[model samples]
Structures are given as structure tokens and as C-alpha cells.
Target chain A: MKNNEITDITPKRRLFELNLGDVWKYRDLVMLFVKRDFKNSYKQTVLGPLWIIIKPFLSTFVFTVIFGMIANISTDGMPQFLFFMAGNILWSFFSSCLNGSSSTFIGNARLFGKVYFPRLVMPCANIIYNTIGFLINFVMFFILVLIYMFTGSNVHPNLCALLMPFILLSSALLGTGCGLIVSSVTTKYRDLGVLVSFGVTLWMYITPVVYPVSQVAEPFRPLALLNPVAPLIETFRYGFLGSGTFPWQYLILSFVVTAVVLVFGIIVFNKVEKNFIDTV
Target chain B: MREMNENCVIKIENLSKEYRLGAIGSGTLRHDLQSWYAKKRGKEDPNQRIGAKQYTKGDTFLALDGVNLEVNRGERIGIIGTNGAGKSTLLKVLCRITAPTDGRVRFRGRIASMLEVGTGFHAELTGRENIYLNGAILGMTKEEVTSKIDSIIEFSECEKFIDTPVKRYSSGMFVKLAFAVAAHLDAEIMIMDEVLAVGDMRFQKKCIKKMRDLATEEDRTILYVSHNMNTIRDLCDRCIVLDHGKIVFDGDVEDAIKIYLGSANENFRALEYVGNEHKHHADRNDLCLQFVRYNGKEDSNLSKKSYHCG
Candidate 1:
């Protein structure tokens, strides 16, 4: 009902008035952003959205060769191609969220300086756009899953597979939450920008992407498990490949960490949004 | 209280915005921490943050200070100021793009602004797509934009290139589309800032006429900022002249313009006098140098004289 009663804007607003309700009113803007992101990212490229699948496939090929053949990384008895494909696809989804949203403020300084809307929409749209790429890349994933099944391999996608979307959502939320914090920080200290992109690469190494949790020894093993993304990726592998551990406790832990991180990101982001135009 | 009549759509009271000049913040984390520590210790902020200092020297400034204004529905108010007079800053605060450092801005109805042309326009998106995107950014729903799509294209005069990516369009074509989209926003209050400077004279006239219609027929409130006095005088019924972020004059368009134009000539005269500033106290050699060997005159005929102008 307050929608129609004049907006009173003051210098000192409540720090935590997330105003998600206002975001829903601008749903059309978010859709346009999704559309714009797709158009801009895919446009002019010769292959268009085909680049979505091609990118993951090429990376998977490289990852499988280097980690599986050269270094002989473990895939938990699953085919190297299928395992790397899943890992690359899922890891990309999470990293893209981080990489994309982390620069949301710096990348959008011009647009943000001119207009007003829920600042969250920019990062939210990033996740959605990346999801589009992930889904297209999902086709490559599905085909690989089918290929292993037809060959009578040990790729048994189980009922746990139903949880894949939810797990991916959690990873996206976790990445976006962390990305929001980084985005706000980078606006002040640009050094973080360089650190984050580099950190993400190091992050993928520790998340058991190229190897399985079972292959890591005890001390390093627990460290990998402590990575918030580790359990989600493990759950994803368990769901889609039926070979990884699935402790509900870890999943619950991942969910809680994601919830906390997202709330913190929003709080920091909300504070940054008010005066960022000055410092940014 | 009278300004709060149902007819009034906007009220800005005791509005002030302070900005630290040289480099925003303390330029480094140590200084930022020092500023925080200053606040904690109940000491004067070493950062000298907030509060507008006179422009005579240093970086701190007030973009707006204790400014108060009210506009009734259907009023077209022109805001004119020299660069950095806070015209754009006030509009930015009005649009909620940036929060004011102090005071409040009250808006009775939805407001859409053209802070700049092609604000969110991406080069890769087609002109048609940008129309929807821009409209949505202005807070229009899909159904509303779809309904106006045809008219928008016609108004922009980019019918043939509607499907083509905007990157290929000339700057003029882009502004036309952007202005057309802004024109279609049905909000009760509209704010514009120097965006009309784009495009040709004929299109500018068209836009002025449309703005007239919007104010008169549509019963909308308009706040416009422009350096073009002709557009301001021709379109706005009232004017506010801003000098160093404060409204020096707020009244009838012609009178406010007279004050604005008067100050401008004063500034020009002041600048003209600035050329003589160094001469008033020039070093002896800089005072007057008469070139030698001109017209076969010998070097011995050269003259160097010093005379203080003041």
C-alpha cells in the first residue's frame, strides 16, 4: 500500500531495508537485463550461443587430458571425460557467478550513476545469465552422461540427481553472495579485483574438481571438505554420477553458509549502493 | 505546509550534499582508518569530511546546502547553472541515483528522468531491443512498453533501423530513440538533465513542443536542467538559477534568466580582467619589453621598463 504514497529519500536510510519488494516491481528491467546480457555476450561471435557448449567442451577436453592422462587425477571410477565435463561445467557456473558479479559495481559505474533501481538486480541478473550458459552447457553434460550409460560404464545417475538444480542454485547463491562482497570491496580497493580472479582459479584446484574427495589424503582431505563449494560439488557429482559421498550434514552446512554469506553480501551491498557513486 | 497541497508533486527541504574534492575518501586505508579513529575519539575529523567549505580554496564543497523548493503538478521548472553549480547533482538526487548528504527529497508520484541520453543503451542490442530495455529501466512494464512500441519507433524516426543494432546508428538516431522512450514514460513527474543537447535543431524543436504538450495537456510536473537559455525560457514557466550549488534566484523564468545572464556577463568581465592580473605585479623584466632590431633599430635602442598597473 505504501507503493503509491510518495517516496521520501533521505541521506540516512535504514541499513537493512533490502526493498526486495521494489525489485519485483522492476521485474521487467531484470528481464531486459537478462535479454541484454544474452544478446551482448552472444552477439557478433561467429558461433553465438553455440559458444556456450563449445567453451565447456573445449575446457573439459583440456582438463581431462592434463589432469587425467598427464597427472593421472582420480575421477572416482567414472570415465575421465564425463567426470571432467561435469566438473568443468559446474565449476564454471560457480566461477562465472563470482567473476561476473564481483565487478558489478565497477562494470556498471556509468549505468549506476545515471539511473536508480534495486542494485541487487545487476548481480542477480549475472547469475541468471550464467545459468543460461550452464543450461546450454548442460546439453553437453547430458550427452556425456548418455554416452557413458550406453557403453555400460559405471555412470549411474541416481535419484539424488533430482537435487542437482537445488545444488546448483546454492552454489550460485554462494558465489553471488561472495561476489557482492567483493564487488563492494573492489569499489574501494581495486587490488581485490586482481586477487579474486586469481583466487578463483586457486579455488577450483582446492574444490576437488580435477580429483575426487576420496583420492585426497587425510589432512588435505578435511581442508577440501571445508571449502563451502566442496560439498555442493560433491553433492552434484553424487547426484549426476552416483559415485561421490552425500552426507546430508554437509549439504545442510553448505546451505547455512550460503544463507549467511548472502545476507552479509546484501548488507554490505546495500551500504555501498548509497554512496558508491562518490567513491566509485 | 502550503507547498504540500495535493497539487504539489515534489518538495525538497533543507537539502545538502557535501563532497570531498582532491580524491574521494582519504585516498588510502590508513587515512580512512584515521578518519574512523577521529570519529571514535570525539575529535575533529582530520579528513575534514562533510560540510561545504567555501570554493576559495581546497577540495570540500557543498553540492546543495539547506536548499528548499516545491513544485506543483503541471509546472515546468527550469534549472540553470554554470558547470559544477550542482544542477546535475540535484537532478541525480531527485532521481534517487545518489543519496543527498543531508535533508530530504519528497516525491508524490513516480518520476522518470533522462539524466543522459543512451544511459543503459548497449551497442550490441538492436534499436528495438533498446527501446524495451530503456523503457523497462524507466519502470515501465512489458505490456505498457509493447503497447507503445509502434508509436515509439515512429516517434524516434528510426523505423527502418529498428531491428538493426544501435551501435551502427548515428549518435543522432540513438538520441532520438532514447528521447522517444523517455517521452513515453507516463509518470506524473519527469526530470531531464542536459540530454536535449544531442541531435539537430529540428529534433530539438520537436522535443520542446512535446514537452510543452506533456506539461500542459498531460498535467505532469517537469524539472529540467539545461545550459540552453532559449530552451529554458521557451519551455519552462519558472526558473531556478544555481550558483556554487545554491539557488541564487527562484522565480519567473524571465527574471531568473536575467539574474543568470547578468552573472554570466559579470563572469565574462571578470575573466577579461584576469588577463591583467599578472601585469599588476609583474617582475621588472616582465613589466614591459620593447623588442630591439625592429625596423633596423639597433639592440641598444631596446627598452625594458617596469610599472605597476594597480
Candidate 2:
């Protein structure tokens, strides 16, 4: 194709065109980043990857004391420990994706300044690595669910549990979308970095992670459902505990919103990736 | 004489890049506020008009301006210029790391650049992992990278510590691994920017040999940028000399160096070099004479040996 013709395509369409072909082409590099993040995450730590389990376990325990016992928050008839652990695991995944993707541009500014690669690859690799972390955390959660089952709690395993993969993927897409947008803006106006850290923390309160959606009386119920993360977590809790309210409409809305945000994120990200080295 | 039928791989037409002078910080805020006050009074902003005039003064500079050039496939082209002559900027634009403010650059085939050592390496990863990572960053497929992994590790000679995190590797080993990964990238156009200057002489020689083999055996288009004139003279078939953002010479390697050294005379008086927190004349004082101004008198040139010190 001619040079002008090449430049004519929008960066969004260009990124979609890049897809697996470009990713596969750089598969070795992605693995390197994955290896780097994984190895570095535990390097010099006394317990190494065990900290992965310990971190979420400690958070769940602390939240159960503060929110479940102290605040007396209702858990939609599920065991307090299982309820809090589920929320903690899901929140960790979403927050990690947002944090990882948001820092993608700034974190790699040195490499970006000197080299040319699909800038998308850095965040993509981060998501993959963080997903591995999520998987490890999920296994720990699974063990907890087994313990709850033996304790005479009503923990039914439904066929719908098979859809947890799709739920996790949706959560990842939502996080990636939000993260890319934040990263793109942060490249120009660094104030967004500070804003995102506080913003994501406040965002968790709105999601059904700490409390059940049914507790939010009617008019505010839809408002809580508007959050894409709310549906993903609710679905996870529903598939396992068979207690929390699951609205298909909200799930569809979440999917649609995730797709749109992802497209917009990629567009802005592609444009910034081209010349951010200069400005950054 | 017949026209050379060698296929051109890269073409630049009237390329230019402009950078704003002065610190782009609080100074801009004061200027903006002053302009706003002037506009409120229904008068032209005095600072705005004065600022425009100051930019037009000779003090302002262009990094690269209306430079046109071409490189044929399999040709080793050396770009030689003083610091701030837009050499790195040109390479950045060619590699798509930065965009030209104006004009166009057209190139065929994939381009792989090793502009800086350890460009894509993550210190937390092992040497073997970084090999794959850096390979992918250079745009190689996993299968393509897997096939070359053994050779890359062999070339780096760090197989014993391949699984050790790169943060633990010695700087020399790090450079070797980074260079090996860069060298193995399968690209039609390879751009190396002063990476040889940092490593030991033995490794530098190895890099030069690798570059020469790539150019001669693989028929790759190579653009080598370095201040080491001897390396440029020995390796490049043709050279392009850049001065004050413009191409002053584009021809045989030897002739380009001559023109570049010759043009250094016009700018010598105004040139300033800051070295280790001290400012000094860029030109050698022993080789040049200070101005001998006489009202209404024509300037005269003295013989090279008889020239007085500045």
C-alpha cells in the first residue's frame, strides 16, 4: 500500500487489524514481560509467591472484621468468610488490571522512548500476568468454598458456574478498557495518576463487592447495577452461593459498555502511543 | 554513465521538525496572562508581538529542516553530524518512535532499531526470558523467535546464567545479551545508533563484524549513526552530512566527511561547548584567529601556519 493510504486508516481500526498477528509476532516479548513481572513480583520476598495467597487472605479477614462483624453488614445469607473472600478476590483482579494498565505508559516510558513496538503489548502482557495472579487467588477461594460447604452453609454448585470464565474475561476487558483510557490521559496530564488511585478505591464501594445488591433499595438498585464490575461480581457470587440478585439486563449492559470502552480506549491509546515518547 | 539500478529502500522528501525554544513551563503562564490582560484592554498583546519577534531572531533553531535523501537496499549509510544536528531525531522519525512535524518519510520493508542498549529489557526477568521478550519487542513471532533462541543465547555467551534474573547479571553480560537479541531480529532495515560506543572494544568489533555481515550477506539496508569517524569511513559505502538541520553533503563517504569538516569553519565562532559544568570554545583556539576589525577595511586571510590565536 502507498504511504498516504497507510496513514489514512484510523489507529483504532489499525489496532484491530494488528490483533493476534502482531501479538503472535511479538509473543516472545510478551513472555519476557510476563516472566519479568512474575519473577520481580516475588523477588527478595521471604515467602515469595505465597504472599499472593497471604495478601488476599489477610485483606478478607480484615474486611470481615470491620464490615461484616463491626459494621454488621448483611451478606445475602452466605457465610461471612466466603462472602468477603469472594469480594476480595474479584476486587483484587479488577484493581490490578486497572492499576497495571493505567501505569503501562508511564512505567515503560524509558523503553518507549528508545524503541518502537506495539505499545498495546505492554498492558496486554500485564493483564496476562495479573490474570495468573487472579487464578492463584481463585484456587484459594475455591478451597474456602469447600470448607464452607462442610460447615453446613448453603453453597450450591450450579452448572452456571461454568460461565465463571466468561465472567472473568468480561471483568478483564472492563479493567483493560478503563486502564488504557487512564494511561493515555496520564501521559499528557500526570494529575490523572493521582486521581485514578483515589477514584478506583471509591469505585470499589459502589460495586457489590462489600455488600449485596439487594440491600440497595429499588431506585438506587439500578444505579448500583450500572457499574460493569457489579454485574461481574454478582454473577460470580450468584453462580456459587445462589443468593445474590443476578440481572441479565445488567450483564448485557456491562458487556456492551465494555466493548465500547475498549474500542475508545484502543483509539486514544493508539494515537498517544505514536508520539507520546516526545511529550512524555 | 548509466543510472544505477539499485532499488531505493528509504526516501525522505522535505522532512522537517520544529521544537519550541526555552523552558516550556511557568514562563508560558506569565506570557498567557499578559496576553489576556492586553486583549481585555482592546490592544494588541505587547508580549505576544514581542515574543513572535524574538522567535524570528537567529537565536531560534530548527532541529531538522527540509532535508531530502534516499537510501538503496543493501547500502550501508552513515549519518554524521555534530551534536544537536538532528541525527537522532531523523533516526527516531524513521523508526516511527516520533513523527515529523512536517513533510513525509517513505520506507519499504520492516525496520528494526537498536537505538539504545537494553531498549526492551526488563531487569526483573531472566536472561533467557528477556531474549524472548526483546525478540517479541523487535517484532518477531514466537515461532520465529523460538527457532533463533538457541543461536541468540550462544552468541551472547551467557548460557550458564540464562535462568538468573537479568538484574543480577553483570553490566557487560547485560550488554552482550541485549546486543545479541538486537542482532538476531529479522528485519529488512537495521538502524544502530551509537550502541557500539559503550561496550568494550572487543565487543564493539564483534558488533561491527555482525553489522557488516548483515549488510553484505543478508542484503539488509543499514543506517549506522556514530561520532566515530573511523568506523563510519570503514563501514559505510555512502554518507550523508547534516549541519544545522540541513543536508550539506550527500555523496561518497570520503567527500561527505570533507564537506562536514569544512563547514565547521562558518559556525566555529558562535559555537559553544559545555563540558563538565564549564563552557569552552568548540573550535581549537590554536587553529583559528580572532576578528581584527578595522572600520571600512576589507578582511584578509592569513596563511594557516601564521594565524594568530583567538
Candidate 1 TM-score, C-alpha based: 0.87
> Which runs of model 2 end up more than 4 angstroms from their true locations?
A1-21, B1-6, B22-61, B157-163, B265-310
- As a whole number from 0 to 100, the lDDT of residue B189 in candidate 1 is 86
User: Over the stretch B72-165, how does candidate 1's per-residue lDDT look in tens digits?
Assistant: 8899999986566789999999998889989998988798878988789889989989999999888888998999999999999999999999
C-alpha displacement of B176 in model 1, angstroms? 1.4
TM-scores of the candidates are 0.87, 0.83
Expressed between 0 and 1, the share of native interface contacts present in candidate 1 is 0.67
Kindly list the per-residue Cα lDDT of model 2 for residues B97-208, writing each as its tens digit: 7777777777767888889988878777788878877877777767877899999899888899999989899999999999988888788888989876546778777878
